[model samples]
Target: MTIFRLPTAPRSLQKDQPIKFILDSEAIDCLAHNIALVHPVFDVQAFRQLALTDIAALGFMDRSAHIAAALKATLPAKFADATEVLINTLTPPNAHTERLGLGVFFYLPHTRFVAEYGRDHKHNAGEDPFDAAMRAQYELTRRFTAEFSIRPFLMHDFERTLKQLMQWLDDPDPHVRRLCSEGTRSRLPWGARIPQLIKDPTPTLPILDALKSDPSLYVRRSVANHVGDIAKDHPELAFDLCDRWLSHADKELKWVIRHAVRHPARQGNATAIALRKAAGGR
Candidate 1:
């Protein structure tokens, strides 16, 4: 196999210019190299053939989707089988980051591939495949945030998925805790909207409650964003939660409450305004 040298940076289209596409050839080269390292059986030639063809015409996300589709074609026939192969062969999170500044970029396509696979086959008889996809995503989160990938499961099986997310609140990994909140957001950017959450965020309150004073700033930030997302559709709920947390809140929890109410406060919500004022406009 001929080794493709990873470009140090994206090739500029002109002097002192940056490439518009995030998923450019440099990214693809890094991805192909890492995948080949992990899964020796991965069809590098086929993957490159599909990924590099019509390359200039595609944008960032389109390039990602194209690579995922190509992966489905080159990997196992069944989605479950292909997912299993990927799960067993994924490179460690730190390894990819050490080599490529955008380590998570390599896994984004895989995450999308699994999510697409689940969406297409979610209505299948047993829940086994969806369960497998969830487990794969959990592992993926250790390497890269799988916040977007987990949404399909939430949409497909809300009850079971929420139950699992609740359990993840106590996980040792802060990334897992963050995913619990981020994945369930009402309006996660670049992600599918959860209308049910937008209507009533009651189901997600328990998870947020557990994470309010989380040790990890990363988890706390997600909790804040999750609350902010709720505020957009349910200001009352957001304020109520903020009030509850703020009553005897520590500094960390206060930070979260402040962030959660920011959007509502900007929108001139009286309760949000009061809450912000009470927090000294922090």
Candidate 2:
């Protein structure tokens, strides 16, 4: 209920100072106020604004990870509607420059929140403001993390997350369905890549299988991208999926298959070439 004010600009100019820089200072303040009313504990505006500064400060002190862990422990849970808020709020593609810093402070933490709350205490029901705020934060965190750069980190948790997300493909919510694909994209640009999925795409097949027919463009785009990521290594497998799905005679499935197999087609791989021939391309 209380407004979480954005932090004052720093006295010294550092590399991280400009990471969260908004040309429209007043707009950032206004947005922060709005988020505060909906979920006060998610006072991330200051953190978002000062992300580079915090990390810079941490780096200078040789405590970046320590600071990150501390913030994770301290930051309040997000608002439930955070995803809706972010989807409707779009920044310019190149806005917010301290990419890695921004990725770590705002986006990475959100991924952890989703993995934690969305997977762990997801069903916990309560009217407590804190609980509501945490859930909201988790959702918003997830939506925001989608914009971060993900690298292939070999971890047991990646497998667990992929399995859980694959099941979410059946979720009725379009957003959750989209996350199922988007979260696992091999080359998700700014997202962490699931190495196992990239090296051996079998884990992602089920998620793609469930989402191939998804009506939401947002969800389908991710499904296409997930398959495309697979095609980077296993062109044959990607072509096989395209062959099977395209045979279904559904326009949407065709579209997804086309997008998914685009990379292989560009590479002139035999499977992709065959798919193109079968799809009536000369």
Candidate 3:
């Protein structure tokens, strides 16, 4: 068993505080080993050859981009074929776990690769590329969270992707339920901004409404973050949601309302103030 140590951040880039674990050489090696286990034909040498140069100089996004490009070089030339091969090679998600780690962490780069490949490729005559990407993300999320990878599909096909997210609100897996809210967040951290969602978050209201009291704290936290993201750009809409959900709020629902209003409350927004007051200023 090989143990991989996370590389230290370079002094010059320490202030930005890059997440060192996700893009380190160890992460690449872990991914290579796992890919080799699942796909005997995987070109481990070729992948490392393309991935390790000047890796220490790159930030998180740059590292992800390099790994993704490396995957394109080493995997099948045909995008669909490569995606299917990866899907088949994926380790199953642990139904009992909550946090992502271990082999799961290694899979994140592959998930990003598949999502990017789907975005860049053309589907067969009757197939929808967005649907294929969504399916790949769904499978990947079982092993590791797909919160970041789902953004591109949401950006390219808002209505269709949103409809699928709405359906995911009731998914059996907490991870999927979390994705429903997290992926749609207007200002998801480390994710590309969705201008349409920032401008008007009305479409996401139904999903939030359904998830505010979700049994999974993991899912509910995402709902709070989703509403909080909306609050940044559309405070009125965020307030409206707080007003509606607060009227008959339970403990869990109250938590969501409080979290959603936190940014606004700090900024002296009237509705946020009222919601805080209604919660006995807790």
Candidate 4:
């Protein structure tokens, strides 16, 4: 039910700062304010104090989890209602596929909140947790990457989640479209692992096929990484897909194939090397 819109200008010039610094006390203050704007009942003082206590020792992800805990403690008890507040807290969605800066990292705790506490089969008493969480990610992905949060849904309900992802292939936002491929990636670093996707990777082939020719390079790059993951597990499947794709690949598709095979090519796999060479070598 969310419509994502990207910003027309760039943001965040401080690329060298530590990633963890993005979620410092300043972040907590701002987050508390944002939630208060949308949720009249949110206790900004309680949320801030709770989120920031003894937080200097925590790392980036730990701080995110800690804030998520604070949000869970302070926000509405019902998952559905809480998700609405969190969604309202999100900034304007990013319209462009690339150039989104560290400003996007502000939502790490938001997505982390969804990933951690919202994993129950039915988070809300009566509402379908999958629907609630997916809707949040569908909008949040535009503001921040939802690839990490979405893995839990894939693990909990592969069929329903994959079906939803399939429907999103034609999404107007490039970020949403890219999520369809990146979220299903079996070997996604820092995300939940799905042994089924690692062992087979066939279920996602339809997803890959749908996105292989996508106009957005951002989407194609994610698809390439997905195939690279598959290549690690099922080189035969990966090789065959690349071989078949090469039969009629355009310049963009060719680049995807090359980048996808680079991992195996580094190890000197003959077919991988051959494929890379045929794709014109990155």
Candidate 5:
């Protein structure tokens, strides 16, 4: 394994603080070491070389994917087995999913691993790739947001994937429920846009409608974001949905509807403004 000495913060900051921003060499060492512990045959030294080489040039997410590529090289070619190793390495999640600390960033590369390689199309494992990928993502989201990773699967088999998402609307974990909306977002920032959804975002409405009244504010916030994404391309659909949500709008639903229409209301869409007002917004 690489001897990862912490990168010293430039002389500008406090002397004792090391720059621990993105996945630095130390992060890779730690991640690789964890994987080694779970999968005994994992070549930790090789992963170090692959993940650390040229890592300085990459940005946050690129660094994540670079490390994932390294894992893809070292781990078992069987997708299910590889993801299982990652699942074993997760720090057990607690009751609260919303305000977890920065430590969740440790799994960023794990999400990337599932995103890039989850769809094992030419499967030698005799199991559906979608099943493996979604299962992995369901686990991954509890540890770290799997919103980005789920996009590829959504694009691969829209209907098949969406069926599962619909079922997840009532998930016990807020993260899983949130993923039902967030993962299907039409224009999720930094996520692959689902063009079909953008053209007719109506498909996502049921998921939002199910979640608009979610107990967790964490889940409700994502519902708002998903609705906002709808508003961007198809304002009519969004306005209509907000209008319906207004029928029994409580404080939480009102907040979600207001946020869902915020941008459009600002852009002077009369319908959005009307919906916002109806939802008791300013």
Candidate 6:
């Protein structure tokens, strides 16, 4: 595994005395392995929070993908310790879904990782870290690939994965269906910019079309974001998407459009400005 090290001190740490942070054995092992080459001093708790926050911040850059890959590689293969740590870290207030968003950011490269660790019928659902890992893995992996990676492959042999993801859109589980949209978002946080779709986003039309009216607000938000991404590139399309579905969209979808178009709107992008105006400041 590549060694990832951070600078011996961050700006904050360098200014203050070194604050000792203790980590449990599993987290310690994971951090040591992952950070061995990375160089930053990690206070166990701080590092974990950093990981979660970084995961949520994926849309900004490719940094989270590096963290996710390093995180998986560094963790002890045995789940006994890691599972407890991960579960304990879960707090509703923290927005576990944001951590899940990291999955989309790191999805394409982690395909192999997910196939190796994702749910297996053989594994029973329980305290098993493997199962939790699998569920978490799929939540991040499948969704991201379905949402983002789907477009890249459409022009070539990628259709297979795309079709498979579409099938997952109809999954019995709401999480899986949500993945179908969230995974494919063009402007998803911490993910790559979908230039092709950005220029002409017809590729994602079907996926967004399928998810536009999904029962889960979770799934629908992604669809809105996916369309909003396209809108940045082609505002007319975004306008059409919103105009066609305005009645069906809830507040979440509107929020996504506002966020995704913020930059373009600021840049005086006529399309986004028009959509912004049409939306009537809601």
The candidate maximizing lDDT is: 4
The 0-to-1 C-alpha lDDT of every candidate, in the order given, reads 0.77, 0.52, 0.77, 0.86, 0.82, 0.48
Residues forming the 10-long window of minimal summed lDDT in candidate 4: 1-10
Candidate 5 lDDT tens digits, 18-125: 334547877787887777777889998998999888888788788889999998888887888888888777766556865565566767888998888877665326
TM-scores for the candidates:
0.85, 0.59, 0.86, 0.92, 0.90, 0.48
Candidate 3 lDDT at 19 equals: 63
lDDT of 6 by residue, 156-275 (tens): 323554565677767665656766666556566744555554566676678777777676667766776677667656777776776665555566555555655665678887766766
Model 3 stretches with alpha carbons more than 4 Å out: 1-18, 94-104, 122-127
Against the true structure, candidate 1 has what lDDT?
0.77
- Distance from true location, Cα of 238 in model 1, Å: 0.9
* Error of model 4, residue 78, in angstroms: 0.4
Error of 2 at 179 (Å): 0.8
Better model by lDDT, 1 or 6?
A: 1
Clashing pairs in 3: none
> Of the pair 1 and 6, which is ahead by TM-score?
1
> What is candidate 1's lDDT per residue for 198-268, written digit by digit as tens?
88889999999999899888889999999998888777788888898888988788888888888878888
All predictions: root-mean-square deviation over Cα?
4.1, 8.6, 4.1, 3.6, 4.3, 11.0
Q: Which portions of model 1 miss their true places by more than 4 Å?
A: 1-20, 94-101, 119-127
Cα error, candidate 4, residue 134 (Å): 0.7
Lowest lDDT 10-residue stretch of candidate 6: 18-27
Q: Which candidate comes out best when scored by TM-score?
A: 4
Q: How does residue 227 of candidate 1 score in lDDT?
A: 90
Pick out the ten consecutive residues of candidate 3 with the lowest summed lDDT: 2-11
